[model samples]
Target: MKMNNYYLELFEGRKNIIILPHILPDGDTIGSSIALFYALKKLEKRVYIILNDKLPSNLKFLNANSKIITTEDFEKLSIKPDLIITVDSSDTDRLGDRAYLLDLCSEVLNIDHHSTNTNYGKYNLVNSKAAACGEIIYELLKKLKIYIDKNIATALYVALSTDTGSFKYSNTTPLTLRIAADLIEKGIDFSFINTELYQNKPINKIKLLSDVLNSLELHFDGKLAVIYVTNDMLKKNKIDISDTDGIIEYARDIEGVNIAVLLKEFSDNTIKVSLRSKYDFDVSIIAKKFGGGGHKKAAGCTIYDTIDNAKNILLNTFRENFR
Candidate 1:
């Protein structure tokens, strides 16, 4: 559906705008936010991209102009936004503590591609058919007649590439690649972005990966593959939670593995679960069961329980749900 003209008018009328992304911002969230930031700035709009967490070290390259508002910066701000545009978040709760700030804004616009999006916005432009939220944002910018500069192109490319696993995942479509090709024509150093985000792994990340792989276990006749990362493991390796980013892919790629799970303990006995399916299986269903959501092949949720408890629950769910 076309974005409502009321939202377009709001965008053209609003003076102070804020672009919000989900907490623990990933590549897609950060990239889409930054791309919009540039697009709005081109129109001389007062805009800020506020995120609840710091950018991951790998994705910091996408911040072409060093413009990103962290929770620390946002807390001290005196300016109330006229408009709030949330990108890449499936639901308002995904905004984390920043969700409350919506009350201060006159309008809320949610732009996402998640199938589970709740449309929690005064005006929402959600396209579940899009491979990533970046695709939706790209279309929005085109409708607004914003020029896609090198920086914007690079950011959108990062957004599209990361969410689609550098165009290797099942979610990638012909249109996805075509948009990427157009972005490349804008003179983005695609090779550098790819290498920096994917190939250049830190030593701490390697240590974390080793420990995680060592903890790997295959269950239910090798169909359910699981790996656990404890706070102690992260502390011992001197690595942050971001280091565990893509380690679940290793477990899921194992031969004969149907569903792969990565369980990591955060603080206060809270465990985060990442799920991946190798075939036609729907991991998002399991994620939604745990009060979280994502695409069919990859999804995640957080469980406020012990590691063992979370694992047992997931195992039970898999046994009962898997066909």
Candidate 2:
């Protein structure tokens, strides 16, 4: 879909802009923000990429120049932003504490690919069918007649490749592949990126995964698999929370398991739940029920309860809905 000309006009008029990515800082959000930062820089616009969380270790390579700033740093800056653009976020709540930026800036542009996006921005560009927000940004850049250089292509490639699980996930489409091909043509070292993303696992992360796998349990006649990660597990292994990325997939990939869940104890009363499913089941529906949202096969929600209580709540939710 072509980007609306009004958005282009907003960009042309807005000189001081802030780019906000969703909390937890996934590849798609980081990549789309970086790609847009470079594109806007070429236009001579003062662009700032403000993030609520630190970039994951594997994704740090994409921010080698340190263009992305922490919220604390943004607070120190006196420059008033003319516009704020949120990328890969479904709703304002996904911005965490930074959601205040929406109220501060009169001109807000929200770009995202999630089907559950709330269209919260004054100007929203949401395409639920797009494989990733990177695809939409790529199209938007083309529509704006912006030149996509190697840096921009590399960022967009990271967004496309990671969100689609390196094109292994069901969300991968022909256009996704074609865009990847175009990115490769721009001279991105995809091999290095793949190695950094998948092959280069820290020992602490591997140890944490071992502990997490040992907590795995099967339910619903082996159709559901569940795993747990406690703060103790993370502290024992000296692992960061971000190191737990992709660990839930181990449960989801098991044979006969239609649904996989990862219940993470973020705090004494906060359980961060990650849900993945196979076949026709829509996990996003379940996530939305809990005030979170994501794609059909993958989704997440935060339960304000003990780990055991969260598990029971999820099990009951599944029994009530899927049965």
Candidate 3:
């Protein structure tokens, strides 16, 4: 939908709207989508939020918890949506099995904060400066005269928390914190949400994290840290992809390590690459070279080949870019 006004553009003569987030949905993805969902519902627009991954339990308290459409449901829906808005999706392919939803809509609006975004939709408001897409959604809500309620505030708060790394990441701006202050004043329980969102990991997740961290390997004068989680690793630990979450963060926390890469083996010889940088490196450029995109500090891609090949490509590129 070609919309001069942000909110009005999303509504562009549409009754049924489908909102999609990227696969492996994070706090920003879910939070941004939920905030928009709240505003869209208040306008009485028929919006169905579709997500391909499991809803991170911390966000269940949001207003649209019951309204989320899963990947399974997206496949079964025969009716095409009048408009489709995708939040935090780096590209059309990032929609995974639900990429078909992009085709089902008459118009597509892309909302995201990734520096490496492909701008895949018909309409896009991509901002790399914003800490989280939820913040952009918050700005969008304000423009539409949407009320700042506890549910919406709580959802946006989670988005800020995660994207800013709890305000520790460089992405956190003074404006970001000011917006956060406004969200907090809306009677959203920060203490409860904080614990639930950050502290409430499953036991299996913790176990898998422990196993993965113990197997961490360092290279390149200890500037790089790599954690490889194979199919055997997942099966032996009795943990799936969900359990592999946060393993990269453990590697990033290592002293003197400027870069962290998590290698998760997928079906066939494919591997997923997650790159997180602590210095002034643009991870997105590396990711974009690999046909992936994200922020400067964190970026990722799914390599259709071996872990070694992927790592070599990254190393060669890093050497060319930074050495």
Candidate 4:
């Protein structure tokens, strides 16, 4: 079932398409799904997107916003799907409640760029080299012979730009810029997308970040900068876990910091960890030891225990690896 070849026949069949993303959908999830939805609908095909979480405010401007369904809405439906295309989700569990949707679809297409992807689909197009799933969707559109207008370009732009940290991350390869260049040439407003996604953080988020930065701790001669945010901290600022998005970037950007870790506590007292590095540190290896996985430079894991326990495991492991 090679999608690269079936571009002709697949587009002709009118199917109830379901496009879904992983829990806590990011820019890559939203942008890639939206771009695919637009292309499918333009060809007079039935397409819908289901997100595991609410759409981030900044990404609400895509042309096909109305087509996105939340997990709650899908539960109330009674329709069988012709195709289920997952974007940015590595495993079935990442789809949360929408995992049931797989049973309703005749075919599954899993698209992702995560190095830790589990390839848990009938068809997988996992390219660790791609900057974002949006880039893969862009390629799929081209294979399907769909034209990229301004709106489609913008949708893809946000996905690649944010996932690559505005083209500053190590994942920003030569092809990444080529896709971005094509999108920009299509008249997508780069400045607007950048401002909307990065510059428009809520004031409370900024305040919470200030506190996280102030409370940051260092280990191994400042090679690893660790920050923690408990549920109490969330209640203190009236913010959700999503508000801590860029805190790790702050740690990674600090002078002399080769690696950064952000330990986030959920309401259930589980501690989620993010790991980022400046060089070939292979944070994915670190995350794997904790039953999680991701990219070489940026990865994450969740421990169903205290931050102290997770931190100890990390510190001890860091000593073993980098010390």
Candidate 5:
């Protein structure tokens, strides 16, 4: 959907703006937020990027000189935002504790590409057809007549590339590539981004991956694959939960597997479940059933049960719905 002219008008006299990314900061959220930050800076708007979690180690390169603050930092500041803009977040729930900002700010502009978005903003520009939120931001910047310099281009490139799985995911479209090509033309280093995003894995991450692979299990005659990552595995390998980002892809890539599940044990009973589908399956359906939501092929939810119980619940759900 095209952005309403009224939404653009929100920025007309707005001076203090806060950009909120999802709870667990990902490349798409971070990249889109930073790109907007640079663009708003050029407009002489005082903008702040506040994140609920720390930036993943691999994505720190994108925030080299950017001033991204934490929730604690925001709490200490006396500034009340004139407008709140959320990027790549489906709903206020995805904002974690920062959701209260929606009530505090009278004006909100929610920009996202998730089909399951709740339209929780005062002015929402939700386009499920867009491959990434970066695409929406790029269009918004163009409409505002903002210049896309190398910094903004690099940020947007990372946003589009990561959400599209380096342009290999099924979501990639002609417009996606066209925007990416434009960003590349701005002199962004695509090769360096590829290296940092895909190739620069730390030793601990490698060890964690090896350990997680040993827990992989196949069900439904290899049509479905499941992997487990417990707190013990993370402690043993000295890796953070963020390191498990791309591990589920390994399970999804299995030859006969149509669906892949990653059950991460955050505690004794809190299991974070990530689901990925390779074909026509819509994993977001299952995620929404469990109070979470995402894209058709990729989604996640937290199950308040033991690892074994969570796996059984997912397996039963799949059998009831998919079998």
Candidate 6:
């Protein structure tokens, strides 16, 4: 899929631009936003990234230039952007408070790979077939004839690698590996990236993982696995919220478990639920029922209830849908 030239034409002579990634930023969102940011900077476009939270600790390497600004910074700015580009977000709500910034812009370009994308932008480039939005951004760069520097390659590689679970997930395709190979050809230290992302777990994270695993519960004839994380656990272990990243994989990896649910208890009343399915069952349906959306095998939603209540409702949904 080529870059929508209509949006490229909109880009011509446009000076003020902002690129946004979804809140609670992930590897895919950060990688896509940074890759696009560097590309636009090469074109001498004045661009900024609207980030709601601090960059994830593991992804700090991708922020070498440190150009990201908080939503507070955006609010203080008097200049409204001429263009806003949202990358990897399925819908505007995922933009958090920054979603309102879209209304102030004259033109918006949405780039995403999620099947549930809402086409909220004036010009949308959505390829659900792509393994990652970084893949789409790579294609768009090709269409625009932009040179991908090493930094750009590294960012895109991070996007593809993480979203596809380092090429282990069902989403991994031949094209994904090819793109990764091309990135390697650009001399990215793939080994180091893999280590930093997967191997370099801090002691706090390890402790949190231990607690999370200890709390794992099985239901529905051992087919549904559930893990819970409470704020109390984080407080005791001195772990940040980000430390819970990928903790759900432990439950999902268990033998005979068809689905895994991670019920994270935050300070607020809401419970964040992360869902993963082994095969056949569409977890996005479950996510959407609770006002969220994601891929078929991997999805998440926030439940405004106690951890126990959220876990019950989610497990029951799994039973109703799959059993």
RMSD of each: 1.5, 1.3, 2.4, 2.1, 1.3, 1.5
TM-score of candidate 5 relative to the true fold: 0.97
How many clashes show up in model 4? 0
CA lDDT, candidate 6, residue 21:
91
- For 1-323, candidate 6 gives per-residue lDDT tens digits of 45667756877988989999987788898998999899999989998988866665678777633878887787788778888999999998788778888888758999999888888888889998999998998888877888988989999999999999989999999999999999899898999898877888788888888888999899888988999999999899997776687888999999999889998886577888889999888889899999888899998888998888888887677777655
lDDT of 6 at 64: 37
TM-score, prediction 4: 0.93
Residue 143 of candidate 1: its Cα lDDT? 79
In the range 106-160, model 5's lDDT, one tens digit per residue, is: 7898999999999988888999999999999999999888999999999999899
Which tens-of-lDDT digit does each residue in 16-120 have in candidate 3? 888888877778888888887887888888878887566655555554458787767766876678888989988887888888767676588888888777778
Task: Give the Cα error of residue 70 in candidate 3, in Å.
Answer: 2.7
By TM-score, the better pick of 5 and 6 is 5
Candidate 5: segments with Cα more than 4 A from true spot: 64-66
Residue 185 of model 5: what lDDT?
A: 95
State the lDDT of candidate 1 residue by residue for 72-116, as single tens digits: 687788888888999998887788888887888758989999898
**Stretches of candidate 2 exceeding 4 Å from the true structure:** none
Model 3 segments more than 4 A misplaced: 1-9, 57-65, 75-77, 321-323
Which residue pairs come into collision in candidate 4? none
Each prediction's whole-model lDDT (CA) = 0.87, 0.89, 0.80, 0.81, 0.89, 0.86
Q: Show the lowest summed lDDT stretch of 10 residues, model 4.
A: 1-10
